[model samples]
Each structure stands twice: as structure tokens, then as C-alpha cells.
Target: MKMICMAVMLFITLLSAGAQKNIPASDIKTAMMKATRFMVEKVSNRGGYLWNYSPDFSRCWGELEAKPSMIWIEAGTPAMGNVFLNAYQLTGESYYLKAAQAAADALIWGQHPSGGWPYMLDFSGEISLKQWYSKVQKGYIHCAQEHAHYYGNCTYDDAATYDSGMFLLRMYLLTLDPKYKYPVERCLDFVLESQYPIGGWPQRYPLRYEYVKGDKEDYTSFITINDGVHTNNINFLLACYTLLGETRALEPLQRAMTCVLALQGGKPQAGWAMQHKLDLNYSPGHARDFEPAGYAATATAEMCRNLMRFYRWTGDTKYLARIPDAFEFLESIRYSDAQMKQLGKSVKPGQILCPTFVEVGTNRPLYLHNDPDHYWVDYDYHGLITHYSSTRAIDLQSLKDEYQHLLSLSKEEATKDSPFIGQTDISGTLLSHLMRGKVQQADTQKVDSLLTILKKKDYLPGRLPSVSKENPGFSDAPLPSEVISIKEYMNGMSTFIQYLTK
Candidate 1:
């Protein structure tokens, strides 16, 4: 029976390879380049990009309605720029490199003097950007805490600064240009300086603690692990140490890793939270009202992966010690079928189900509801908000499998696979590997479909329900008219790049 399964898998692999061979490489390259050119030339605002834009290019946005001079850093500009770099690696085209350079230039222009970047960069300057923040804070009813006041500080939230710094590093490596090096150095210094004495980083840097929600002070200054803050920062510094031989990043990186270990809750809970108090305790009610202080299922799951990554990076057995308890805690708190139905969630097969927010001390699942005027959280699951999910899909089984796999590896075998293995500088293959880290196999059928669509539209289609003055914010709702998405274009381009490389 095992032989039969093996034979089936081998046949499937051959079939996939054969199918790929049938597709002309030149055709794929042509489509990829055309799509790339359209985005780089027509859609971009000053060589930078937003999340999405209208098909006609009449409307565009990045978490908010952006001005002509503005570009988003989080998954907008840097993401597109990375794709351009990937394209250059595959084809060795100066065009792709030049496009990437333009993106790097834009990011450099947006770089705050403090050595990091904000969520969005506006060419119009600081005063205009602060005024825009005030407008958003006054108009938006939800997420009041996030926009309460503009602090003119670089945010670690959503990986705005970290990702930009990475792009700059990549550019510097490729061009051997000082233009990219100085900013990336400053960016690294900012990270090292902004870290808490105990090691965790705040949601926003240069800690103001001014953002007020009701009577409570801002959560931005807390030691944050939300959005993989520790993980991203650690990886960035590790890359600096590995690729550039920057010694300053090494000690700070160790401190940050130690902070992750310190932040874990005690035995019975044995999980992690989105943010922690400076004293290293669980912090809840962060950025929004519905986020109650407790063990966040998503954050805990990510923490488990972070531990695994740390183990891989350093061969530290201690990192693996807490993972089992974390897994057990996750399994213990899963929502039963009755609870899921009450919460209007259906558990698909093989889906690891749990609530997004778990209450502290008692370990009860917290459900969030959107009232007419405000968002609130409680035990009741009924009438949960549609905007944000009350339940999260965390594959604890995958985490367990990864942990087991790591344990099975000999130390030599594990160390050989580390990114630091015998590498002094970034090679094309290594950089490409980093770019495509842990991503699932790209679907050839989807690539073919996207390429066909791109030919007609000259861009990838995105979901945009409506774009009007009344509803200026973006939405994921399906609409009749196709919209252009930076993310989709990147994904499509990446798929082609991956196939071409193979």
C-alpha cells in the first residue's frame, strides 16, 4: 500500500513536470514582462505603489485614500519592489533593476530622519501627513486608537519599517551602491536603539504614549509581538549579520530572541499575547477595543513558529522546550462544534479551529460584537462582527509536525540548512530562496489563468466593492469592474519567476 502511494506521487510529479514543459518559456516571460511594465509605468505613483487601484487608474488606495504623492510601505511599495528585484535575478534585465532602483529611491525619500519609515510616505511632507492623520482620526469610527493622534514616529506594526530596510539591503547588495547602504545602516541602528532594555520592541518607536482610547493610555509603547514584530526584526538583523557581517546587530538580535522566551505566559497558560507590558506581562485591548488582553491564538501560533525558527537558526534545544506546552494549551482551548455554530463558523476538514481572543486567568474564548456605535467584546458569540473574524484557523498540527521534524534532524544536518551556512554575501540563489521562503508550491493552472487575464487587462484583477467619496476606505467585496492589485500582480509575477527559475 505504501509502494502504491509512492508510485502515485511520483507519477503526479512527472505529470506536473510534463505540463510545465508544454508551456513555452518565452510566452510566460513575455506575459510577465508586459504585466511588470504596466505596473511600473502606468499604475505607480512616483515609482512607488499602493495596495490597489481602479482599472481605469481613476482611483487608488493603500489602507486609505492616498494622495498622488503618497505610497504605502506595508505590503505596497516594498512588496512591489521585491518582485522587481526577483525579476531582475531571473532575467538579468537592466530594466527590472532600474525599476527596483526607482522603488528604492522612493523609499529612501520617504525615510524618516529617525532611521525608519511610517505606514505611508507622503512626498508633500510631514505637516501635510499629520493633518491627514487628524482627518482620519476624526472621521473613522472604528480603530480609533490607531489614528487617535499622529506621533510622526516610525511604526513597527505591519512590518512597515522592517520590510523597507530589507529592500534597501537587497538593493545595496545588488548594486554595491552606498546610496542604499547608509539608509539600511541607519535603519538597523534605529531597530537596535528602539528595542526595550529587556529586548521587545514597541508597536511604534520613540515612545510617546499619547494615543488615548477612552481613559486608557496608548498600547503602542508596549513590548509588541503582534504582526510578527520580534520575528521580522530578528530575521532582518540575522540577514545583516549573515550577509553584511554587521557585528552590531548580533548582540541585539540575541536580546530580542531572549525577550521572546521571557514573554511566554506561565505553565497553565503557556501561550503568548499580541503585546506585553514593559514588565513582561500579557497586554490586551491593543489598537482596538475588541482586542482584550489575553492569549491571542494567532500570536501564540506565530510564537510557536518563531521558537522553531530560533531553534533552526541556533540549534538551541531550549527553544523547543516550551512548544509542546503551547500546543497543548492551544488544543485545550479549541471551540467545540456547538460553540462554532453559535459563532456562525463552520470548521472545514483538517482545519485547526480556535477563537481569536482567549481571556486571561479563566482561559475562556472571547467573542467580539460590533454595536451600532462601537465595537465591544464579551463571552457571547452571537452577532459577531463581520469586519473582523472572532475565530481563527491555526494549524497546530503543522506546528507540531515542524517541531518533530526539527528534533529528528542531527545538529550538523540542521546547521547546514541555516541561511548563515558558509555564506559571506548574498548570492542570487540565496536571495531568491529568502524571497520564496516556506511558500507552498505555485499552482501552474492558476498561473496560466492569471497570465491569460493579464493579457487582456495588462494587469491583475483585484476585488473592490466600491470606490466613492462616501466610502473612501478600501474593501474586499467583489465588484463588476476589475481593479488592479499590487499583491496579485506580485503573486502572479512571483509564480512566473518561480517557474522560470525551476
Candidate 2:
């Protein structure tokens, strides 16, 4: 009996040791080099990038803000910027630093006087300057007369300027460069002011409260929910609070959470709307003719997660307590497997169809669309280019998993949600290790091996992200190869190095 017990203990000890020592430092270094090469060789243009690149190493035209000749896609800029930062830290390489700095300089040049970045940046000085001059004539920017600035509509729509601004701030923190600091500060201030008095943010600021054209109008100046705007905005605030020690950040965050809490609608079926009315009421508000005010499962799930994050950061029980209400609404609307079968879609048994939007009170799914030619459905100037709004039935696996995890959590676990919580798995684990001051003894052999796989496939610049969308109506453009997305490259390599090095 004694011998059997001893054997069992020995086996357990061996298992623990084997599980922990999975990564190596040397392989991580090699992965870093290959990723750095890709960023420098294939990802960059004249100090900027097209929104997405093709595998064939050809530049793709911008999808939203990209132009054929000289546009820098804003969506992917931060990914490249952070990759350069990681390379510099990993190798102490001046080459990576130079690349990172040049991107910073471009960001500075493109910084709008309104304190945000445009969707895309055009590097051709004369064209950008001339455009700003046109805005100057309209007095959109008082300083436009003083100097030409990139004045594309400063927006937080779909994580626009906010993401770009945060990346610049991260760079500023490490490099302590003056150029990065000024824009970061201004952008943050703009973000703060963009918050509506009701504590939610408009997709764009200085508030284009209503969209009116051809006798059709709807309010757009309300708090936004699409693309995780509220969650992303408050996350930015939390980042400032945690890293910058910006105490003033707390007020806006609290107000924003309070706004979210109040706007959860009413009983048995209370969930969040995609866009809440601007009057501080809980009622759903219209956005673009097709996106009728409706309860959004995607936005609600994200908000609950972020609220838990806020509660963790603030020790504020209010944020934690508010999550169950959201959970209930999500539960009430679950699409049963039988119903999914009727749709005849390839859905799994446990899987549910989380409608992109649902009827506010009935908890029924909402379907909507309108010809943009007749109405001001899109708030941006490029509204005509958007496809008609369509209903989306997305996989609810992630949200379902997160909901179950939240149900099992104690207060202690709730507070642990963070920026690093849901990032790339290996990188986030490495960050957790580094934060604990455990790097010297960490098991890097496994992580290094994993990174090697990541380099060959993820960091490979073989396929371009330029899809066959009509990005430009009239341009002598070459055909593009359908390949892995910019996200795979950007998120894959950028996050890996940031976690390992930072």
C-alpha cells in the first residue's frame, strides 16, 4: 500500500513538471527574426501599408479609405507598428526601431486637428494638404489654414481612431518619443470629449447627430453598439486608468458603465440595443435605415465581459452585479437546435444562432434593409458603397462559453478579466508569466516551437488580403489572390512578440 501511494505522488509530480516546461528562448528568437523580415520586406509601403496585402507581395487598394496610388490603410497600421516595436525589443535592433519610428512619423503627419486618424492616410503630401485646405474653407478645422492636416472624418466607428491612438500611446510609453506623445494626448482628449452626456459614445464626434438626405433622416448621434464600440471605448479608458494612472479616466468610465446599466431595457426580456436613443432612455434607436433599433447579442455579450473587466479594475461591485441581467436576456433569446435545423444551415447541436439583431421587446429576430440610394442609411460619406443591411446568424460558441464561465466565477475570478485575458493564447500566457516575474525560469521550449509554426504560415506574406470588392470604381488594378487575412499576420506575429518582449 505504501509503495502504491508513493508511486501515485511521483507520477503527479512528473506530470506537472512536463506540462510547465513547454517553450524555449532560442526558437522564439528565430521566430522573431522571420516575422521581422516579413514586416519590413513585404508589409510596408512608403512608410504606410494598404489595408490588406496580397500573398504575391503586391499592394492592394484600400477597402474603405485606401486608394490605388498612395493610400495607407489605417485598420492594419497598429499591427505593423507593434510588430516593429516587438522586433526592436527582442533583438535590440535599431533597424526595427527605425521602421517603427517611420510609422510613428506617418501617424503624426496624418493626425487630424480634431484629434483622430482617418480611415486611411494618403502619403502624397499635396493631395492630403489640398483636401485639408478644402476642409479649411468649410471651417471644420480652425488650424487648417495654419497647416494642412489629414482631416478625414475623425471617428470611433468600428474601432477606428481609438485603436490607432492606443497603439501610438503604447509606443510612446516605451520609446518616450515626443512625436508620439503629442498625438496620443490629443487623441485621448478627443476620445474623452466624444462621450455623450449620457455616458455612451457616438460613432463620430463633434456629433453628426442626424443623417438627412432626400427627405430621409434618422438619428446617428446616439451611443453606438456596432463593432463593440462601447466595450472598446471603455476598454481604452481602463487602459489609461491602469497604465497611465489617469484618475480622471475613472469618472467617464463609471458614467459610461452607468449609462450601459440604465439602458438594459425592462424585465423578463431586457437586453441591450445596438444603438440606444440619444436621450439617455433605454429605447432602441435607428441607425442607417436597415439596422433598426434592436437588442444585439454580440454587443451585449461583449459589454458584459468588459463590465466584468471594469469591476475587476475598480473593485466596483456595481459593474459585476450588472452582468447577470445581460446574461438573462441572452438566455431568453437562445435559438433552439430544432429551429436551427429548420433553417437547414450547417449548425451543430449545442450551437445556437445568435442573430446579429433582435426585436427589442419581443426578443424576436429583426430583419431590415433599404436602398441607400433613397435614404441616408450610412452616416459616412461613402454610404453609397455599402451593401444593403442584411441579417446575420453568427456562431454563438464563444459567447456561450464565456457566459458559462462567467456563471461559475467568484468575485476574485471576475476581477481577473483584462486586456491580456482574451488575447492570443500562447502570447497571453507568456504575458502572464512575465507579469509574475517568472521569465528566467519559464518553459519557453514549447512556445518557441509553436512560434516556428506561426512564422512559416502566419507570417508568410504569400497571399494578399485584397478581395474582389469594388474598392475603386475606376482604376487600372491588377487581380489579387485570395489568401490568409491581414488579421492572421497582424494579430499572429504582432501579438506574439509584444507578449514575449513586453
Candidate 3:
């Protein structure tokens, strides 16, 4: 959340060009120094960051919420708090720790008593404290469910609060500060309290549902996968249960995991809906219009990976066994080359535009209306579309390799147990290698190389948005070249930051 980065051409080039290129530690150290300097000089603001920015000496321009701005860092960016901690660990830099502490302080200020934080926190007035008030008294802020004017209420839809709480957990681990630990514990409470009695989490909580006539609609309170509500929260619970040794965390984790497993569509079907209805009987359902209720190819892939993560965490074959069918669901709906040629779309090498959604039972790919506000989606017929958001493509040719690897795991082959044992880990494996103290010069060099490439990409000019109208608290947009991406890291630079700093 600190910075927006995209998939860089250099990364893909390197990947396809060489398989097992090693990077040196010194190179990584130097790149880290430069990257941190850039972050502190250009990105950091009172310990917070604009989603994306382009700096020139003392002046800079920012873009957030798809709008250009002269400067703004009012919301988001707490994830950087932990990223800095990781940086401090790698570099032994007090500067990084200090930066992290400042970010932590910002998160503390933004946090709600429920341990959730809003997507954006504007502190210009008394709005911060007002956000916590639930009364109908004058000057008291209303819940977003009650009034749209309220902006600082706890949110998890875009990882608003859960992510910040996770940062607090890291800070607590680093400093042993009660301030940090307290919020983390309350955040855990929020997770437990927020979970639907049936187990899944809503996009937002306190389960605010709309009272329409005599009926109730869950609204944002539905079990959500839009921004990884349940998965991210389950991940936090897993961390608490594992790292903090909080036995109480176990039940919720298990329940959430069970809910996820159950959520996977069974027999004659597979995969998960991006969001689901509150009713557990219908495990896959809808949230918004654009997000038609169906099997989301993207979320299914993430769910498969997450299952693998749980398997690795607990050595539970149940999670491992969950992998293939999801993959099966994925492969079933993949667009055939014939289909692509039929559509008259030029395909990227090693990539295909996979269906973003597949109609349940029917197993047909869905294409929705272009409008984000509302959409009439149809899976019964095809449509001409290329936008990444509507129908995001994936380099599944690479995934086929992983698919085969996971499939091989089914067999008790000795090599499959430790395939990388005698072979090179060209797949950018990091955690285990780092833990075993087998981190080589090449490992750091790879990160350094990536950071160097990203540093350059961060400065590129293309597809710059020029808003048609001026926004409150911001100036007229700069030239498209002067403007910069706030959400650039949405691509894959986030992985570089995580990998290099770790």
C-alpha cells in the first residue's frame, strides 16, 4: 500500500531469458540503500505515503482514487510499516526502524476501537475522533451503514483495517510495545466478532445490512472475497495462532479454513465465487453488479495457492488435496487457443486472457457491462473485451509447471519431495532458502536487480490519467507526464519490495 508498482518488462525478460540466475548480496545491499533513500526522500510523508507519486527534488505530484493531486497521503500505506521492519532486519538500519515507528504511530491514530481502520483517514479536523462515535449526537460521526458522509469507519473491503492491524502485529513483535500488542489483540477480537456465525467474513462488518421494506439484504456484510476479506483475516489469525501462540486463535482459524474448504464447489463443479451470500447453503454468491456471482478464475487461483500455504503451515494434506480440483476448475474454463484465434485477439506469449468469471453449473465464461457502477453480465454469449480489470489475463503456461509439480506430489517420488534438492531453484524461492542460511550472493542480486528495474519503471510515463474535474483538497492535474501512479505496485512490484526487504 505504500507504493504502486506494476509488472515490469525487465522482470519478465529476465525470467524468460534465464532460469537460475543468482544475485549477489552486496548488489542487493547497495540497491536497498538506494531504494530506501528514494523511499525516505520521495515517498515518506510524516511516516505515511501517497499511493503513488513522482518526485522532482522538493516538489511532487500524486495520484490516488484514480485522480491526480499535487500532494496527498491521507489514507492507506500502513503495510509499509512492516516492510520497513523487514528492511531494518535486513540492513540493521535504525533509519528503517524509525521510519517504521512513524508509520506505526500513524496507524495507531487511524485505528478504530474495533481494531479496524478506514481505507482513507483524513485528519484535517476533529473527524478522526468523530469517526469512532456511534451516537446520533451533533458532531458525532455516523456509521457508513447509516450515513455515507462518515469516512473513517472500520473497513476490510480493500484491506483497510486488517492490513493495518497486521502491521501492528509486526511492530509488536519488533518492539514488544503494549500499544502495538493491544491493537493486535483487539484486531483479533474484531476478526472473531466479525465472522458470520457460519464462519465466513463480510466485506465490512458489524454485519450492517440494508433494511429494505421488511426484508434485509446483507449489502457489504455478505461473506466477501472482493478484497480477500476472509482469506486475509484467516491469514492474520494463522499468524496469531502460530507466531503469538494464541490458542484462542485456533478455533477461528479452523472454522475459517473449514468454511473456505466447504466454500469450494463440489462434484461436477469446483472453484469459489469472489463473494458469497451470508447464507452458508449457497457458498458461492454475489456482492456487487460488476462482480457477477460465479466461479472467479482469479480468486480460485489465489485460493489454490492459499490452500498450499495452509498445507505448508500445518502439514495438512486436506489443504493440499484441495489444490487439484481448484486447478481442475481453472483448467476447465481456460480459453482455448482456438477460442482466442476465433475472437481475433492477439495473445501474449506464455499468457492467455482467462475468464474472470464462470457461470456456476453452466460453466460458461462471463462478460459484464463496462460500467463499474452497474452491469448486466452475460455468460451465455461472448463479447469483445481487452481491459485487464473486466477480464484479467494470466501467464498460466507458467502455472502449468506448478500444476504438474503439485500433481507429482500425489506420487511418493523422492525427487518430488525435495525437487530443488539437486536442482536449481529458478522459481524465485526465498523463505526456506533464507531460513536455512543458504541465501547466496545471487539471491540478493536478484532482488537488487528487480529494485533497480522498478526504480526506473517508477519514473516511466504512460497511460497517465487526466481527471476531467478538479477534486476537493487537490489542485488541477499536472501534465500526464508530470503525473505518476499511486497504485502502480498493484502489478507485482509489491512482491519485489517484500522479497528484497525480507
TM-score, each model? 0.88, 0.70, 0.68
Residue-level error in angstroms, candidate 1, position 291 = 1.3
Worst 10 residues of 3 by lDDT: 135-144
Better of 1 and 2 by lDDT: 1
lDDT of 3 by residue, 176-293 (tens): 9888898788888888888876678877655455533122354566677766777778767766765677788888877887777877888546788888775635556765545667
Q: What is the clash count of model 1? A: 1
- Cα-based lDDT for every prediction: 0.79, 0.59, 0.58
Regions of model 3 farther than 4 Å from truth: 1-45, 53-76, 125-152, 210-218, 312-324, 344-353, 371-374, 379-474, 477-480, 483-502
- Model 1 spans > 4 angstroms off: 1-21, 143-148, 280-285, 346-351, 409-430, 437-444, 465-480
- The parts of candidate 2 lying over 4 Å away from their true place are 1-43, 53-59, 125-151, 209-219, 346-351, 368-459, 462-468, 476-478, 482-502
**RMSD for each of the candidates:** 5.5, 9.4, 10.4
lDDT of 1 by residue, 1-502 (tens): 9999999999999998888756678888889889989988888778898887777666666776556567889878888888888888889888889899999999998888889888898888888787777766655655444655788888988889988998899899988999999999999989998988777888888878776768656888888888878888887888788778898888998888887788888867888888787752544445567777788889889989988877776777888888898988888888788867766667666567898878888888888888658777798877877667778988877888888998899876765656655323445554555555223245678668877896787887877533222242434443335568887788788788777777
Alpha carbon deviation, residue 494, candidate 1 (Å): 1.8
TM-score of 1: 0.88
Cα lDDT, model 2, residue 370: 37
